[model samples]
Target: MHDATEATTTPKSDDELKELVSLARLVAYARENARDLNAEFSAYCLDLAFGALIQDLDRSGVSLSHESGQDSSLFGTRH
Candidate 1:
């Protein structure tokens, strides 16, 4: 989860990028697959925005998914 207190200027870590992409995909899937056009459009916009985030992370060499490892649970760790 993002918080107002967290420094927004710092680059996201690999873990953060992975989690962010996962969440973006989840939201896009749920919203885009809905019966309403409004929902689909909202999902499209969200997907577009998240795509930029993905590209930025990609440029930094962060992968969207792990091939062979346990995925970290955000709730399991605390800053």
Candidate 2:
């Protein structure tokens, strides 16, 4: 379970790097306005963020649900 060469591997891809940067920014933003983020506002933000993420996944050809599952109507149509 130890490989020295593996530790020296190349950096992450552009997409991965961008995702990290985005997460860092989001964290920093939340920290900057700690008190302003109340429970209701946080819940709204989470819903919007997750909805956008699901939409992006659909656009990228990723399906979140199957045709014969109980959670089929949870996400609605791909579009």
Candidate 2 has its poorest 10 consecutive residues by lDDT at 70-79
Give each model's clash number: 0, 0
Off by over 4 Å in 1: 1-11, 34-40, 63-79
lDDT of 2 by residue, 26-45 (tens): 54344334435565666556
Position 21, candidate 1: lDDT: 66
Off by over 4 Å in 2: 1-38, 65-79
Q: Candidate 2, overall lDDT?
A: 0.45
Please provide, for model 1 over 4-66, each residue's C-alpha lDDT reduced to its tens digit, 9 standing for 90 to 100: 345345677868777766775564455445424567667677666656555555555655432
TM-score of each: 0.41, 0.36
Name every residue pair that clashes in candidate 2: none
